[model samples]
Target: MSSPTTYHLVRPHVVTEIPTLDEHQQQVVDHAGGPLLVLAGPGTGKTTTLVEAIVRRIDDGAPPTRCWR
Candidate 1:
């Protein structure tokens, strides 16, 4: 069988909070099959958004080894 594609966390940062994504953020989080760039200022929930994104991937069954190196 073919190996599933991988998803990479945008950057390396510990996720401490239970991230909750809104509709727009959820859109970005779900688009984990390719390059994604979230450009915005600080305190705009970048980490929260990213955490949700990663969590979603894990929830879908991707392992750590399959993610970014």
Candidate 2:
């Protein structure tokens, strides 16, 4: 008789820190709903703002998969 193999699944630890948002950035992050358009020049924190907004949505019980889409 052959013995069954055992497998262990482990999730890696990840450290994510939210950066401080400026006044305009905060407004965008706090937007309730509707089509929002962001226009800014270079060196602005557009990517950061987007990421934090998505994080906030996920924190508010939104599905991670939906957030990505």
Candidate 3:
């Protein structure tokens, strides 16, 4: 009889600070329903802001599909 080898996957724990969104970004994220448009110049945290909004919706018990059309 031969013994089998086992491997365990491990992920590193990362600590990151949540970005502090400005008033403009906060307004966009707070609007949960209806159609909304976000336009801004470069380095305006567009991706981060949108991602945080989606996360907020999910955390609020909204279905993933409901976040989109």
Candidate 4:
């Protein structure tokens, strides 16, 4: 028998200009997209991040109608 010695994690979000993420919130913001479902308890900034992502997409030249926001 053996015991695992280590754990590995990859911080999901790569913030382009935003200075910092509160480590905890980084993963939440990162997993905000794609053809998947996200569900969790309250007090998470899920809605806020979604809005931020949409705004970022638009800022980065994605046309209004082209953005999935």
Question: Clash pairs of candidate 2?
Answer: none
| Tens-digit lDDT track of model 1 for 7-41 | 88697687775656777788888785766777879
Q: Best-fitting candidate, measured by lDDT?
A: 2
Model 2, range 1-69, lDDT digits (tens) per residue? 898999988988989776989999999989877889999988799999999899888998889988643
| Global lDDT of each candidate | 0.74, 0.88, 0.86, 0.62
Model 1 regions more than 4 Å off: 1-19
- Mark the regions of model 3 whose C-alpha exceeds 4 Å error after superposition: 1-14
Order by lDDT, highest first: 2, 3, 1, 4
The list of candidate 4 runs beyond 4 A from truth reads: 1-33
TM-score of each: 0.61, 0.70, 0.68, 0.44
RMSD of each: 14.4, 6.0, 4.3, 16.0
Give the C-alpha miss distance for residue 35 in model 3, angstroms. 1.2
Shift in Å, residue 25, candidate 2: 0.4
Number of backbone collisions per candidate = 0, 0, 0, 0
Candidate order, TM-score descending: 2, 3, 1, 4
Residue pair clashes in candidate 3? none
lDDT of 4 by residue, 1-69 (tens): 798799898889866664354555455445545774556567666666666666667887779788763
Instruction: Indicate the residue-level lDDT of 47 in model 1.
Output: 80
Error at 18, model 1, angstroms: 4.2
Q: Is candidate 1 or candidate 2 better by TM-score?
A: 2
